[model samples]
Target: MTATTDESAFAAENAFGKGEPNIAYAQYFTGDSFLNNLVTDPECVVGVHNVTFAPGCRNNWHVHHATSGGGQVLICTAGSGWYQEEGKDAVSLTPGVVVFTRAGVKHWHGAKADSWFSHIALGVPGENTSNEWLEPVDDAHYAAL
Candidate 1:
C-alpha cells in the first residue's frame, strides 16, 4: 500500500532532483535585507536568505550567533561582489561560486565595485540564533576590491 504524504510546503516533495521545490520561489530582495526566519532542526539548522545589492549597496560588519556555531555562505547567482573579514583580505565572487566564513567572525559583504550583487545566504545550526551588526563597509575598502 502507498502511504502518500501530505504536501506540507515544498511542492516537489516527491520530486527526484535538479529543481527547487515549487514552494521555494526565486525571491528578490531589492533593498537592504536580512533573514526572516531561522530553521530549527537537530541535524543542522539551515535556511536560505536571498539578498540583492543595489548598484552601490553593502552591509555592515556583523557576526553570527549560534549555540553550536555557524557560518555564512554566499552563493552568487547574479552580478558580482566582494567579501571581507575583519582581519582578512577581500575576495571577489560571481555567479556559480560559493564563499564561506568562520563560525563567528566580524565581516561584511556586498555588490562589486561597479555592479549589483545577489546571493543566497545559508548557515549552520545554532541556539538562540542571532546577529551583531557592526559598521558599514566604506567606499575606500570597497573600491580596493
Candidate 2:
C-alpha cells in the first residue's frame, strides 16, 4: 500500500518500528525514511538498523568501500521495494528477501512507487570500510520500473 502521513498508521503497519526522521541523511533520499537502531553497543561486531521507506522513497547510489572483507546485507521485512546494482536488473523486495551487496558495488534501493517498504541493514565488519554516497537514482529510470 502507498505511504501514509498518519504516524499511528505507519507504526501499526511497520513490524520493526520506526525511529526518528532521517534528517541526517535527508539530502541523499528522494522521500521520507526512518531509521531505528537495533544494535548500538560499541562492542557489537556488526552494525544493525531497521530502515523504513515511504512510498516512492529511495536512497542515492552508494558504495561501501573496504580494503578487506566489507559489504552490506539487507533483510527485507515489510511491503515491497526494488534493489538494483550498477549495470544490473532491479531485484524485487518483499518480506524475508535478503540481498548481499559487496563492498564497492554501486547500487541503490527504495520502496516501490505504490508501496511502503522496510528492511534491516547489516554493516559487515571490515578494515578501512567507508561509505561513499553518490548520485540519486534518475527519475526517468525509477518511473520506468
Candidate 3:
C-alpha cells in the first residue's frame, strides 16, 4: 500500500503514534515509511525515533560507520517485520523483540508483505558516525522471505 500520513489501524494501535512522511530518506526505501522523533532535545546524547513501515516497505542495504562505538538498537513496538544482515538469515520481528546492529554491519529491516511494522530506533553514541546507504533489497531477495 502507498505510504501516507493518514492514521491507519496500525497507527492507532501503536502507542508511539504514526509520524509524518519520511521524506528525507524516501529515496532509500522501497515503499512508504514514517518517522516520529521521540527525542528532539538537542541536549540528548542518544537519538531516538519511532519508525513505522508500510506493508512490503523496506529500506536498502546500508551501514552505520563509526570510529569507536556507534551502532543502532531497534525495539519492535507494533505489527510484524523482518530484519536481516548481509550473509545472514533474516530475523522475524514482533512486539517486544529487540535487535542490535553493530557499527559497519550491512543490514536492512522493514514490514512483512501483509503487516505493518513499527520500531523504536536508538542511535548509539560514538565518534565519527555516518550512514552509508547501499543498493535496494531487490524484489527477488525480498520475495524469498
Candidate ranking under TM-score, highest first, comes to: 3, 2, 1
Flag clash pairs in model 2.
none
lDDT of 2 by residue, 36-108 (tens): 9998898899999999898899999999999999999999987789999999999999888999999999999
* Cα error of candidate 3 at position 10, Å: 1.7
Query: TM-score of the candidate numbered 2?
Result: 0.92
What digit string (tens of lDDT, one per residue) describes model 3 on residues 1-145?
2222334767666899879999999999999999999989999999999999988999999999999999999999988889999999999898899999999999999998888889999999999999999999989999999
TM-score of each: 0.66, 0.92, 0.94
Instruction: State how far residue 47 of model 1 sits from its true place (Å).
Output: 2.1
The Cα local distance difference test for each model comes to 0.59, 0.90, 0.91
- Collision pairs in model 3: none
| Tens digits of per-residue lDDT for model 1, 1-145 | 0111222221232121212222321132223433322334555648765665544557777888766767777776666677788888887767677887766788887766456555677875566667777766666776666
Candidate 3 wrongly placed segments (more than 4 Å) = 1-7
Q: Candidate 1: minimum summed lDDT over ten consecutive residues — where?
A: 1-10
Relative to the unseen true structure, what is the Cα RMSD of model 2? 2.1
